[model samples]
Target chain A: MSYFSLEYIAMITGFLLIVLGIWAILTYKNLLKIVIGFSLFDTGINIIIVSIAYVKNSTAPIIDSAVSLKDAVNKIADPVPQALVLTSIVIGLGVTALMLAYVLKLYQDKKTLDIESFTDLKW
Target chain B: MLYTISTLILSLIVLVLAVIAIIHKNITVAIIAMGTVGLFTSVIFLLLAAPDVAMTEAAIGSGLTTVIFFYVLNKIKNHDA
Candidate 1:
């Protein structure tokens, strides 16, 4: 592969984001920061999915003036991953909201956001 | 050629913002950095020829998500008072 290709750059960035998110999740003691890590992980996954769908010299999947019906097949990027990423984004938002609610409840119960403080079920 | 260079720059900005979001001592600054990451990610999506995805990311990822985070933070602060 080329050293500075579009797909490579995007995919590598996505991978880096995933690594960063994992590091944050593992190292951060605060529940809110862990939630941020999860968000980063979600964004990374979406970027990777989109990068995988990119085709060389292709436009969008839309069939407008830019891309006609006959030539659209080869001239357009994959639409399936784009649709999948859309669903993933909505799901990520829901998951983030749910996590925040859980964090709030935990804080209300113990007045703390530290993961170490919530060791009621720890073995 | 141009696309590659722009993507490289945007990706670098995103990675930097993500690092700031993770390492910043102030939670508010971290949240803002994270939101900016989303905004740039959407721009990258636009460059990738996924305009629909770009719009969704900008509205939901950068706009609504940031608002939600700030709202929760406010609630927590109010509870502390």
Candidate 2:
């Protein structure tokens, strides 16, 4: 397919991910679901970043004899998204782990996992 | 044109699943739906030429997160006391 063709698909998918993220946050009563929603939001943003880097009929950013080094570098995909995804993935992992640990602590303290059951904290 | 139409269809499917996840009363179902959302989102990332992001989403978003959610759910389930 064409380059823009891929981008168009990515745009639509990114939009859907955003909508899903909102829905997850708004309707799910579970704290875990909320955390998942945040991840979903992150996924959508990543998609947007990748789509923005799309270029027409380009190869990987590797030097080759078939194409001059300058041309290869010029047509190479943006490295920015790759870097961003690396950071985001680490962040996502850290947050999820922390959230799970908190959930365990909450369970131990409250003796229940239902968020609605933890009404004691509220003033 | 064909590509656009396919993308639209996939997007619509994603939207419908998201709505279902939100409205479902069963928390388990909602969590599963969230996993589905992650799967589709990764697909979108792949389409967007971000294989790195797609890999991360697929591994962490759909994989580890789901396992953690299920583990927590089980803990709560068995200890309903």
Candidate 3:
């Protein structure tokens, strides 16, 4: 594979992220680590989306008066992925904040952050 | 070529960190390792051409999450044992 090929690079990175995420979930007994694993998984999905939008030899999707609109369109990067990434970022921030708040509350009530200590709710 | 090698190295680093985080007896050290994994994942996001995602990963994944973990650690006693 070519060293600079965007697709190959993206695929490898995404795959690695996924594997790390799963490992995090399996190996960590901490609840915080499970959340981190989910975050890693989310990052991998976002990367895959953006990678799918990549086109070989494409330029940024900005319109320029010097270039014909049709020609510019032909070489422009996909805008959909950019928009999706923005949405995903906002959602991620919201979720992380909420999770943190919950963690604080859990610690306050239980006086412990260890997942093993929180056996009261277990079925 | 370069991208592949860099991604592989970063992945290996993340995996090692995750293992250390899991095995570490110190809760604080494990939490810090989790943040390191987040930082590495953000770099991978950048390599995947998702700058926005990378920014979010760095901010929430590393910054807010680490802070929350630390806060919980402080609130709880005997977490390291």
Candidate 4:
């Protein structure tokens, strides 16, 4: 079914994941759960970016003995998104790690995971 | 042809796990499920022919991030008691 093409499905899924992640962020009271939601949202965005660069039935953007320069142009999927996502995944890790560090500091001060408990910040 | 179908299905399953990770009441289970979400995302990246992204996701998203969560959670729990 053309309606269920590869990119379409990925696009729909990406959008759905983003919406769900946001909803979770808004609904969850726990700090860790909110971080989980943020991770999901970041991943959804990555998926959408990669899916946008997808080419139907195209091979990966790798040049080998099998593909000559001219033929490779049309046969390989775009490479930009993959490069971008590599950094995105790493940076996502950094941000998540930072968030966890904050969580630890907050819990140390308040000894609680509930978001509603923290309001003072002057240390 | 088959790869496309499989990847789409796997991504959809990831979507489900992601939702669980965010909304589940049990904090530990939800975080574990988030790791699963990352693993599946990597798999989907493989199916899409991006091995670099897939490895990065598996290492960072599935591996490191989950462990950090567990580490912090454990520390928080210990501090509470």
Task: Point to the candidate with the largest TM-score.
Answer: 1
After superposing candidate 4 on the true structure, give the runs of residues whose Cα lies further than 4 Å from its correct spot.
Answer: A121-123
lDDT of 3 by residue, B1-81 (tens): 566578667767776776666567776788798789778877866655556667777887778777876776665554435
Interface RMSD of 3: 3.8
Q: Write the per-residue lDDT of candidate 2 for residues A18-86, one digit (tens) a residue.
A: 777887777766777776677677767767777777665444444567657767766667767667776
What is the Å distance of residue B1 in model 3 from its true position? 6.2
Report RMSD for candidate 1: 0.8
Q: After superposition, how far is residue B75 of candidate 3 from its true place, in Å?
A: 4.5
TM-score of chain B of 4: 0.95
lDDT (Cα, tens digit) per residue for candidate 1, span A2-113: 6679988999999999999999999999998999999999899999999999998788889988788999988999999999999999888999999999988899999999
DockQ of each: 0.82, 0.44, 0.32, 0.75
For residues A23-94, write the lDDT of model 3, one tens digit per residue.
877877676667667666766666677778766656555667744687976776677886787688668757
Best by DockQ: 1
Judged by DockQ cut-offs, the docking class of candidate 2 is acceptable
Candidate 4 clashes between residue pairs 3 or more apart in a chain or in different chains: none
lDDT of 1 by residue, B3-61 (tens): 98999999999999999999999999999999999999999888888988999999999
The best candidate in terms of lDDT = 1
Better candidate by DockQ, 2 or 4: 4
Per-candidate total of colliding backbone pairs: 0, 0, 1, 0
Ranking by TM-score: 1, 4, 2, 3
lDDT of each: 0.93, 0.71, 0.70, 0.85
DockQ of 2: 0.44
**How are the candidates ranked when ordered by DockQ, highest leading?**
1, 4, 2, 3
